[model samples]
Every structure is written in C-alpha cells, then in structure tokens.
Target: MPKMKRGSEIPHWFPLDVAGTIYPSARTRNWNYTYRSGFLLKEEVNPGLLRQALEDIHSRFPSFFVGVRNGLFWYYLERMENLDIVRRESTYPCRPMNIFSRQSPAIRILYDHRRFCLEIAHCVADGGATLTMAKALLARYLQLTGKEIPPDSGLTDLTEPPKPEELTDSYREFYVKKVGKPAPDANAWQYRPPQVLNYLKVIHGILPLEDVLPAAKARGITLTDYLMAVYLYAFYLAVPKSRRSSRQIKVSVPISLRNFFPTETLRNFSLFTNIGFDPRAKADFSFDDVLEAVKGKLAAAKTKEAMQKLLSSNVAMIQNPLVRLIPNVLKRRVLQIGYVLAGENKFTTPMTNLGRVTLPPGVAEHVEQVEGILGGSAQKRINCAMISDERFLHIYFSGDTKRTEVQREFFRLLAREGIRARVECNIREEEDVE
Candidate 1:
C-alpha cells in the first residue's frame, strides 16, 4: 500500500477482495452487474447541499474514494483526481460504472425531487456497505439543512476518522484451511421471460411487515427463508411444465459475512448459498414442501463451520502462487471462462434481503422508504432485492422480461394469504427509455 501527498491531502490505494476480482473480468454490455440503493424523502433534494454532503462523506470513506487501475499482476484501486459531483436521477437504476474512464467515479450519487440514489459498481462494496453509506449521506445532508440529528442515534457521523478495521479485507482475517469445498448445485431450470426493446420493468410491492412476518413465523422459519420459499413457488408457477425438466430450482441467497465475522470493513464481504428444490423426485410439490426444503437447505449450508470452509477456499485460490504469477490478460481470460461455466447459469435468480434500515429521528421523520435494486445477470432475466424501514418492506423486481408473471404470482401468493400488496412501475403509456 502506498500513500502520496498532493498539497495537504494524502490519497491511498488497495487491492480488490477475492470476490471483487471477478467483477472486472465478468462484466458485459448487457449485464453490467452493478446495483443501486436510495431512500425516498418527503421533501425534494437540494443539489448544492447534497454536493457538499457528498464531499464530506467521501472524505470519511477513503476506501470508496478511488478508481480501478490495472496493475502488472492484479487490478487495484487508486484515488480519483476529483471526487464525484451529485447529479440528477436517470430513468432506470443500476447503470454500469465505467471505471476505466478517468471522469467516472466507482460510486456516483443521483438526486431528483425527493429521491437520493447511489449507483455503485459492484467492485466497491456490497448491499450492506452501500446502504450504510447511503444512510450516512442522508443524515449528513439533513443536518446541513438545519435538522437536528442526535449523537446517541445509530447514524454514523461524517466527522469521525476512518477506523483501520473498517477498511480491512475481512476474508483474510477470517480464513482457515479446510479439507474440501462445497459442491456446486446441479443445472437449474431458468425463467426466460419475454423481452421488450429498450425497456426494463421494475415493479415494487410495498407490503406491511406485520402482514408478512406472521406467515413466516407460523412456519417456524426466518423471514428470508419464508420469502425464498415464495420465490421458488413463484418460479414453479411461472415456468411452463413442458419446459421444466429434472433440473433443480435454485435461488442465490446472499448472506452478509458480518453476521458470522467481527468486522466493519465495507468492501465486498458477503457470500451466497444457492438453495434449490428438486421437483422431479416428488409428484406433488406443495408450498409446505417448498418451505421445508428451503429451511432444510439453509440450515445445512449457512452454518459457521460451512461458511469458514467457503471463505478459506475462495481466499486460497486468490493466494495461490501459480494464480498470482499469471499475467492480467491470462487471468481475465480464465475468469471469463469460469463465469460462463459456473456463474448465473447455475442459479435460477438472485434474492437479496437488506434486512431493516434504522435512521435517526430527524432523518427518519422525513424518510418514507429505501430500496435495493440488483442488476440482471447473464441469460438470467429476473432478479429480486428488498429493503425495509419501519412501515413497509419494499420488494423490487428488476428484469428485461416482457411478462410480469413472476411478480404477479409472487405477490398474489402473499395477498391470498391475507397480506396487502400494491404494485407500482416505471413504465409510461407511450414513452420508454433514454
């Protein structure tokens, strides 16, 4: 690691984590593989105040105040010449970050009316870290606008110095050697939703947590497990019986590494478990069966001991001497091949739950909702992300598919079970995209 002084400020650079190294090589024009998160405020945004807030926020998070640079061996992050300036919102979310361009920031902020959105390149961080940064930016912007945010509140401050532990690659700290690795899931049946030109449908269902939590509790499973069951059931309904084969139906559930490890570093510090159900074995596959299957798979896969092996295996590959000696050109070629062979094709779709976001009283009063939107994966058309505040869980369905069958079936399942569901989308009667 090297730091340089340009006048009064010193900038720092770092190596990408084991997971992050895949993104630079794996990204394509269609599947940019980025994500966006934002909060809907009661009042409109003030760009001048927001710009100042971003500068302050960037200063506190040096890990994000950098750009991707290709090193002789591996790619690394170097400080950007100019910190990002806030811009207005775009028609759609999760646009790719052109990290190779000197003008672009790895993470950019967009604002329009009452919404403040952060579109982050996956290389910088995952949902947990990105949401943490979003809340901090919001809190700081509100304070600048003459609102009083309490010191005792859980909101992080812009004035606090960056802690060393916060910038650590936690995988390195938590890794331990293991005998074997988890086997990849068998090929799964994919949902190939019909596609429209120049448009991606983003439908959100804002339902009361009170309505959904009970159903999850009644089945003796966590909220995530219950929702995943709903997703699997939804897939079962959407796909034609003729198209479905003996292939398993799997959903990639991203698990936050913070739960098992002790660290606050905001880099890519999460792993996923691909939980699947094999419909071929049983003639009658009920929702109860789906729920039980999900619960069993999660229990077996998400244990601390299991995750330790996973971390160890991934880090071992990155740290391998033969892998390290390979040039960047050859390394990228190998990664690109691996991505196609064992990437999104192996899982049906990705399902991420951002849990709940708690805000300070000042910030909470004006904030109505928060949303996490995942970019589409290759060939895999539909992806789901959810975020919750005090009132409702906002579930976003992001895809280029023409049909809304998955969204319709999933929410209808909830509605039939006594949960209130409302549908909203970004499409107009006539016009579409940019």
Candidate 2:
C-alpha cells in the first residue's frame, strides 16, 4: 500500500454532483437521504483490524473521505483529515448523519458481530460508488487479517493514487444543449400508515437465485422487471380495494448511467424513472398485466436516448441562470419546496437493485451474505434495495411505518410461486409475529 498524505497536501474541496445537489437541501433534523452497502462475514469482526483497514484505504477514495460544507450558492465537500471513523453499531443502520459538522464524515464504517457495513449519505456518492468503496474496504480488511486477496475490478488497489476521472461529475460532461426535458409526473398514491418515529424496521427476504432467476427468465423479463411486477402486485393486494383507484401506484427505479454512458466517475451518475400504471385505468390488472406494464416502461426509460434526455433535464435545472443566482440560504428553501412538489411525492416507493455483487475468490470465501439497504423517507415510508451473490438474492425492505402489509404480501407472492425465502428483521419477535 502507498503511504498516506496529510489532508492539506491534497485537493481539499469538491463540488456536489448534479444528483447530489438536492440531498442537502432536502435534509431535516430527523431524516436525510442515506443508504447502506456492505457484507455480512462468516466470522466475527475484529474492530481493531477493521479500523486499521479503514485508515489504510482512506487515501485511495478521496471522493468519499470528506465532509459537507455550505457554500455561498451551493453545498460543497471539504476533505476531513481524521480517518478514525470506524465504530461498533450503536444505533440503527443509515441513521441521520451530521454532514454540516466538519468534525463528522459523510460516511460511516460500522461493525456488529459478523456484519460489516458502510452507511453513506447520498450527498457523498451513489450506490455504484459506495459499493466499490465497500468492496475495497472489505478486501483491505481481509488482507490485513492475513488473507491473500488478489487484485480485481471490484477491489480498488490501495497502492495506486486516486484517479482524476473517478472524481468527475459525469452529468455535466455528457449534457447536451437543446435536449428537451422529460415531462413531469403526476403525484402518485402514498401509503401513509402510522409513523414509528425515529425507528426503521428492516426485513430481509433471502431467496435462492436459481429459483428467482428462472422465474424472471420464464416471464421473458429481467430480474428487476419481475421484482417490480411483484412489488406493484403486492401493493395492489395490500391496499384496500376502495382506495386502489385513488392514484397511480408508481415505483421509482434508479438507472445507473454507467450502464449507458462511458464514465468511471464515483460521484452520483444515476437518474430514476417512475414505473407504474393507474389502477383506475387498469381496473382488473393481473400479475401478467403488471409485468408487461413494467417491461414496457423499463424498455422505454432504459434506452440511451431516453436516459440522455432525463440526464439533460437534471443538468439543465442547475445550469439555469435564475437558479444559479439564488443565494444558498434561500436556495435551500427553494430546493426543498421544489423537491416536495416534484420529487418524493411523485413515487410511492423506491426499489433499487444493485445487481449481482462479485468479490474476489479470497474475499468471497470469508463472506456469508451481501445486501444493500435503502433508507425510508418521511413521505415514502417504505423503500427496498436488493443485492445478490451466486447463491441467494437478498431483498431488503426498510420502512418507518407501523405496518408490514406491503412486505408480507411481497414475500407471500414469491412463496406462492414456489420461491421460498428465509426471513429476518430487526423488530422484536413479539412485534414481528403475525
């Protein structure tokens, strides 16, 4: 590994990515848009070695090792010198972060028993970047434990200096002038059950990938398409029949631009499209009906041309002269109102699939499970994220509502299809028992 440098020696500040600009403004005292990505190892974690690994790998990921700062017109990132941020899990995963405090880093390195997790603020980076950092950290941790993990794309080699390309904000790089912005979406149906203040209930449905993969293939759709269909169907079943026609049941699925654009930037490079149908329009929609709708929406939205328009729309907003002239103080309020008017309310729930996670043979051997967890918002109280290994696809639902009807119905639908899941949660046994 290369020797570490003092923070002053390196570039000390960075601009927020186009997608990240909205997160800081949307944050409240109690909640922020955060997500977690990490692995559950087969053996108990050693905190000493884990902390050492974090210190060892910190310099290699400059984009992630920083704190948020309030600029005159926008929020920016200022690098933090302290690397001793690892700690035992003392609170729930993806809890609110103190990003404004220079003393606090935007990312959390947490360990509990055999679980090693990275809880990151969305303002720092997107899922793809966070996953890369998590893989590198896991590899470093294992290597420190005397494991001979070979270099792979999944793991960032600590020996090399941070690349300039990894820090580029690809949105501006690829934005095209005159590209028309996509149409705005109507407000979708919201499942606002009673709140469980400050508490996030997590449920993991671990299913064999073999069963799930064939199920998707049999339907002639991708795994994401299959899951989105089941998710919409679950909502249809969970909600009362009387309320089904209230509004569209839209699910926001984030599409990584790395798949479409040629960029290695670790910053946020993704945009989400709302995929759903109006229950009023399709009065008697079946599973097959929902699957076909999801497929059509995904097919249209996932194309390079469609994504470029969406990306340009986002970049265009920030580039507007009127938007740029607003001071940071009022800009916060404007952005907050804009988010409420056009953001979270437009989607009933968000489901992100990190796809298959591959680790080097040496590191994969020590890992038992890997999954991604999305944080719930005040408006969209229930959200889902999934990541899979060769054996099992781990579907995690993180919710702040008192009810679990949506989650239960989702897993039940899978069970009815002969796809069984081993369920787990953070709630008490008494509370979780049906």
lDDT of 2 at 53: 90
Off by over 4 Å in 2: 4-9, 152-154, 430-434
* Per-residue lDDT of model 2, residues 1-434, tens digit only: 66745453457899999999999998988899889998999999999999999888888888898889999999999888677678898876788888887776888888999998988889889999999999889998998989898665456778877888888899999999887878778998888887776788899889999899999999998899899999998998899887655789999999999999999898899999999877876658888888877886787889998899999988999999999999999999999988888888898899999999988889899999997999868578899999999799999999887689999999999998889789989887685433
Please name the candidate that would achieve the greatest TM-score relative to the true structure: 2
Candidate 1 versus the native: TM-score? 0.94
- Models 1 onward score TM values of 0.94, 0.96
Model 1, 1-434: lDDT tens per residue? 01222323433687888778888878765555678899898898998999888776776677776678898888887767576547888666766667766776688888989988888888888889888888888988888888888877786655566667777789888888764686755777777766543456788889899888998898898888999999999888777678887788999888888998988988889987888798886887888889888886777787888788888888998899999999988898898888767776778889999998888777899898887888666566788998889989899998876578888889988887788988888676465543
